[model samples]
Target: MHRLKKSPKNARKTPHPKADIEAIGEGRRLAHLLRAKRKEITKAEQVRRILDTAHNAHEISLAENVIRSTMHPADQFEAFARLHHEEGMAAEDIAARFGVTAAVVKQHLKLGAISPKLMQAYRDEELTLEEPTAFAITDDHARQEQV
Candidate 1:
C-alpha cells in the first residue's frame, strides 16, 4: 500500500482512500486533478460533474479571454450566450456555459443584447461549457422570443 501525500493549500480535497493509498498511481499523476477526476468517475456522474465544472471553468476562462484581448467582459458573456443559443443551449445552461449560477445567466439573458465579437473569441479559444447541449436548448425557442 502506498501512503498518499496531503494536497496543497489551494487544491480541492478528494476523498482520501484509506485502503487504496498503497495502490494509487504514482507519477506526477495530478497534472490537473480535474483531468484525473474525469478518469476516476463513473459515466453517470461524469456527465453531470464535467458539465458543472466545465461551466464554471468556462465562465472564468471566458472572462480572462476577453480581458487579455482588451475586450469588454459584459460583451463577452453576451456574445457567448448567443453562440451557445445558436448551438441549442438554454438560459440555465448558457449561464453554466460561463460557470455562473442560473440566476446570474438570467441577468445577462434578459437583455436583447449579445456580442458577436465575443462569440468569435469563445470559438477561437474553443471554450468548454459545463452544461450539456440537451439542457442548453431546453425551452430555448420560448426564451428566444422573450429575448
Candidate 2:
C-alpha cells in the first residue's frame, strides 16, 4: 500500500486511503461510461498519477475547485451557429455530435439569430443571458436590436 507522507505542519492529519480508493473507483466508472459511448478516453486519461513532490497538492485542489467555469451561453450559441451555417451541419446533426437534444440545438440556433449588437452586449456583461434568449423570439436583426 502506498502512503502519503504527512505534511510537517500537520503530522497527525494524513490523507485517508479510503478516499483515494473511492476516487479511483469513480474515475474507472466514468471511463467505462465514456468508452461505452464510443468516446476516446484512454486509461491514462482516466486516472492521472500526481507525484506529491512535483507540485503542492493543496494548490492543485484549490485551482481545480476555483478556476473552472462553464462556457458562456453566447459562446455556445455562436459555436452552434457556426456549425450550422459555416459547416452546413443540420440542427439534428449538430445535436448528435454534441450529445444534446435537437430542440436544445434549435434553441441555440435561435439564440444565435439574435442581433449582433445584443450578442455583443451579452458578451460585455451589459445584458444577462436570459435577455438575449428573449430576443431569440424574432429572427429579424433590426427588430431584435430595437428591443
For TM-score, the strongest prediction is 2
lDDT of 1 by residue, 1-147 (tens): 269666453122233234333322222234345555677643334331122343465554455445323333344455555655656777777666667787766655543242333233334553333222222344454453343
Badly placed stretches (over 4 Å) of model 1 are 1-71, 112-147
Tens-digit lDDT track of model 2 for 1-147: 268665554312223344343332234566576885785665445445445666676765565446534456777888888889888999999999999999999999999878888887987789998899888897888988888
- How well does candidate 1 match the true structure in TM-score terms? 0.27
Root-mean-square deviation of each candidate, in angstroms? 17.3, 14.0
lDDT of predicted model 1: 0.43
How does each model score on TM-score? 0.27, 0.57
Residue pairs in candidate 2 whose N, alpha carbon or C atoms collide under 3 angstroms: none
